[model samples]
Target: MIRTVLVALPLIVFAIAGLLAPLLSPYDPTSGDLAAGLQPPSVDHLLGTDQLGRDQLSRLLHGAQISLAVTAAVLALSLTVGVVAGAVAGYLGGRIDRVISRVIDMAISLPGMLVALAVIGVRGPGVVNLVIAMSLWAWSPYARIARAKVAGMRDSPHLDALRLLGAGPVRVIGKHLLPPALGPCLVYASTDVGAIVLGVATLSFLGLGVPPPFAEWGQMLIEGRPFLASTWWLAYPPGIAITAVVFASNLLGERLAGGDERPSILRWILPARRDRTVCAKDDVVLRVQDLSVGYPRRVVADVSYEVRRGEVLAVVGESGSGKSTSVLAPFGLLDPTAVVTGSIGHTKRVGVVFQDNLAVFNPLRTIGSHVDEAVRNAGRRPVRRVSEELLALVGLPAVARSYPHELSGGMRQRVQIAIALAGEPELLIADEPTSALDVTVQAQLLDLLARLRDELSMAMIVVSHDLAVVSRLADNVAVMYAGRIVESGPLLTVINSPAHPYTRGLLDAVPRPGAAPGTRFRTMPGRGGAGPDDSAGCAFAPRCPIAVPACGQGRPVLDVVTAGHRSACPEEGV
Candidate 1:
């Protein structure tokens, strides 16, 4: 509360001072009174009169109006130019990114004051020219900061989420990208405000600022310099005013640059609330049929799956088997260059918990706000109350006041989960939610997820490389090897009586608790398998221990081995 007051006071004071300068000055700043000349601290002339017999105080106040106006104008103009250029460069990488980056580098390499001077020299000194000159140099700071920030944002999960929501480049950049970028841009703009004021003053002092009768602070300093030794009142008052105003603006900008965690106290006093409800039991929550996701090569192929109400379907595979890709593709979140073909259907709301929690959030925004945004975007009810409740649900009640950087990896993951559950999604897609945490935290998160699944009666699709995770969470299992599902069935049946050679190999790969110390287990060979072209044949044939002659000719179909079990192997048919 104290911090907010300290930050806001200066801005309010400066704004009032800037707006009311003309009406408040005591005397005409340019009119001379020869009888009052060279007076110092007189009762009749507060702050005394200058060498030219002008009211020093009045001139100083009027000068502030010019300096503040220039600063405000420069900040607005520079930030606009910087944000547009930077966002374009960062969002569209490769050639465009390179070209924009090079241009920014060239601009930054030049001395700012010198560039401003050169521009002023050409345009002729005035309030308009000063603003233009300051803006030319000022934009580079925002460009650099925004470009760096946008580079990081390009790979963010929220961006992926927006893309999956069918938002085009313009909408995504305008809505999602611009709002988050505002924090850093504002911080940079504040600092630039101070720099611009100083630049304008420097130019005025050099006779390049507003013309003589305007009474700008920089011009006062320039005009007073000749009489400084005999009449200290001539130069000191305007100089002091310039210092105080710039200092106040800098301090305010610094505080704002830190970021605003909550809105105002008034906003909190009238806090808005929202209500969240669970989906119906009969809802056909989620479906992905024959979903094949490929990068340069096919990473996961011919995978068919579905999640009914209140069920969990876990997709388990090694790191390269495309478990992540399968989930991302169905969400329409993959890069445009990646080839994906599949059909997906779900009547319930869809939400995802990504592998890296921090990557999904804006580092500048509070966790509570992000949760609130999710609730709003999903059109959920009880927005404020549900956001807080969801935070508590994920064991992160205290995280409402914290930014992404302040939270631990596990805490961040929990926050991510809270955000996903904000809308009470009927289908939750958790992709390696526990991969970055320690065992204890991982277990806690897993338990929380299980409880939430039952409480909300939501279907969940869990993707992971850990078979143990699958064993604990999945009611049904889909086993992926290379780029295709080699076996899938009820968890117990698939684990205990696996049919495909690849499934057996995967089961053997799980380390046993009682195994001898340093004992190596059976391993698959040959460079962890082949590229997508290898899709012409059985994806796992090259690595399968029992591969036969026919395994090399063509890929096999998933033949039924039991009522709910299927395997893709000709040898299994034999």
Candidate 2:
């Protein structure tokens, strides 16, 4: 917060001075005495007088007011027109998108100064004309940015769901779409402020901006240019002012775009500590101790687990239960917003297979390129040979020449697996690997994974919301609720005789094999997962069926129910 304020200080001061220029300036900027002409800095005029004997300080103040007003006007006009046009084009993609995109490209391709000059030349130079000229080219860049953002989100499932619920184009765009699109546009606008200010000054310097007698920064610079050697005060102050605002504006944009985890500076200042605890066993491939990850707010808290050679550890929970966060945190896969504090001791070489292969594999690149790149990154020689072998090993043949989009979803997943295997990793992590596939495809992937695990003797961590999905692969199970591990033990022991209420609920929710045809699966009351710190007691207390008043009093810790089995529920014994 302090950092943000510090970054914005210059703009803040400039704005304040511009808004209160009349009250602040001691002498009228336009009215000047010939006797005071060419005077240097003194008590009467702090910044000295211009060639017209005008107070430099007063002129600067009023120049700020004019400059700021024009900048704000340009930004408002450009942002609104550009964002609206771009969003409409992106959302209603077809001939309209292509046309708008072409226009945006042409405008951007044209030199900005030339475009401005052309508009001012035809319209005649004035404050309004200058604004129109700058805005004509300026709005195009903003439109392009907004259009790209909206285009990416146009086909999202969220939009489909909104449309299903009878939402019209306006509400969908205004409420769901425009808000996210506006973020990037505003970030761009921060930097654009400097450009607009500079442009205004440049045009005014060329006598194309706010008419004569007006106290403009560019006008002052032009008027004082001839007297540069004698009266340095006139030009230096305005130049410094412009430079300061530009530098500050650029810095502010960077700050806004980067947020908390700025890789350029913040990462170096406070690096992520990877303090791994040494494992006693030589075969222990992965060990996580007290893993806690947060986005400033605690999400995954004090979770610990380990995977030995040839062993599989399954992290299972509902959405937002921190299942993915806990597993992915060790690999540094979470977004920069995440603040991970934990010790993860793992093999030097680790491979990961994400849930959505479509997202994982670049659509533009051929399957061969991705695999070859991975092979190269793993420090292997003969990239083509290694990539082909990896692809074959994953049961894919002749697919090296094909692009990611040309293949089926399952085929794409196999390609992802092939890419993961390129590293020949000692440990492999799959996060919801089969969540999006059909039953048959999911079974095939799981079987393939099992075969790989057995053949390679590699440790694995599989994350999923479904207990049944991980049953085929995982030897040990760790059930997470909120951000903490609620139950953990051998998969058979936990699944057959679950000690925690949440675990039992999850099991009950799964469809039984021999249940009556009309039987409905049980659903736990209340929401599934929340932040660990959201409640002083158990996060699942509201949803737990066998909850007692005591369950709401304090948080429960894992207690040994049987050998290798533990439950967080204090009432498990009862």
- Per-candidate TM equals 0.54, 0.52
Q: Across residues 1-574, which tens digit of lDDT does each residue of candidate 1 receive?
A: 5765675565566567767877888888889888878788777778788777888778877777877888888888988888878887888789988998898887877898999889989999888888899888788767777777788999889888888989898887777777776678886576566667777888889998778878887888888899888878778876776666667667666455333344431233112211132334545667778877666567766778777777788888887777778777877778998988888877556778899787888875688778877865755544555577678777777778788899888888888888776655678899998896888888888888888776666778899877776687788888877667778888899988888877777778789899999999877776544434443687677777788878878668888989999888758432
| lDDT of candidate model 2 versus the reference | 0.86
Q: After aligning candidate 2 to the native by TM-score, how far in Å is the CA of 29 from where it should be?
A: 89
- Quantify all predictions' global Cα lDDT against the true fold: 0.76, 0.86
Error of 2 at 431 (Å): 0.7
Candidate 1 stretches with Cα past 4 Å from truth are 1-283, 294-297, 380-383, 516-518, 531-536, 572-574
Error of 1 at 274 (Å): 18
User: Residue-pair clashes per candidate, as listed?
Assistant: 6, 0
